[model samples]
Target: MKAFTTLRTTAAPLIDGGKLMANVDTDMIIPKQFLKTTERVGLSEGLFHELKTLADGSPNPDFVLNKPAYKSAGVLIAGDNFGCGSSREHAPWALLDQGITCVIAPSFADIFYNNCGNNGILALTLPQEACDVLAGQAGGGNSVFEIDLERQLVIGPDGAEHHFDYDEGRKEKLLKGLDNIGLSLQQDSAISSFEAQRKLATPWLEKA
Candidate 1:
């Protein structure tokens, strides 16, 4: 996990609503069967194809990102309550694998938002109208966006900006790349010291 202070990058518009998965469950994105594979390439080759495509193999163009503007969208400007659905960590992994580092939306599902932060993805929530404006800009010929996680601002190409807020603890975790497991590991020294003290006080407490 790395801290997120700011990110300025090009925008690829994914305009479809209600179909795009956010903070998706990892299992659904890449089943266990594909988990152990050594290669990290082609993760996006079938990403959402099964859910958003047809049997004959043609793309479900109706899907938000099937359009040309969104072909390789790296920053998703999404809709209200984005990332709402089943709780799955794989969802964020799939998005990250596809090169999306940040998501700007009006709102997000709690689990999905947290999963994204844990994986170093900046999930931002703003006013619905603000998101709409950003989405529109992304659709128009290679738009650029600058997101300063530390300052909590999303700057658009035309110079307009939107501000957002997040939980301080989660922000710090993302900044340091510390997930729950990582956070616990950070306490190793203290935990060890506590165990040593307990052993001195109660030697019999140790397993025989």
Candidate 2:
């Protein structure tokens, strides 16, 4: 998980990316069959699998992801309550594998937000009006966006900026590429000292 600083892209605008899209649960992002593998690398194959493909396994030309403009999209401006349903860390993994680093939406499922932090994905929350504006811009397919996590700002194609809010600690963790395990490990020395004292006080515990 690399540190997330900024996402600058001049690629096609990410229009219709669920601005009206609702209830995009974990299963909708990646189907159950894709869950068979613990490895994250190949999960992109299943990202929006149902929407991106037909029952015959052919690419759905009408889907947003299959469109040529979004083929290389890095930032996803999404709709309200975007990541709903099951708590699957694989959801963000699949998105990242598909080259999407950030997902900005009106709201998100709580568990999904936590999973994103753990895996180095940026899940941004903004007002619905702001998201609608971004969606309109992206729908045009010619807009660009610069997402600066360090500054907590989204620079639109028109040079207008939208400020967002997030926990200061979580922001630092993303900027420093620190997951929960990494955050915990920061206290390794203190934890080790406590363990050493515990062993001294209860020698039989160490024997076990």
Clashes of each: 7, 1
lDDT by residue for model 1 over 1-208, one digit each (tens)? 6566777776754453632234433454455544455454566655565545678978886665566756666687766676766666666777777777798877788888888988889888888778777777775447778888777789999998788998889888877878888989999999999999999999998966
lDDT of 2 by residue, 1-208 (tens): 7899998864333334444575678898898889988998999999989888988989998877888777787887767787899988889999989988888888999999889888898899889898888777776455678999988999988889999998999999999999988999999999999999999999998777
Stretches of candidate 2 off by over 4 Å are 10-19, 139-142
Highest TM-score: give the candidate number.
2
Q: Model 1: which residue pairs collide? A: 1-177, 2-175, 3-175, 24-91, 25-88, 25-90, 26-90
lDDT of 1 at 64: 54
Cα RMSD of all models vs. native, in order, equals 3.8, 2.0
Q: Mind sharing the TM-score for model 1? A: 0.79
Candidate 2, overall lDDT?
0.84
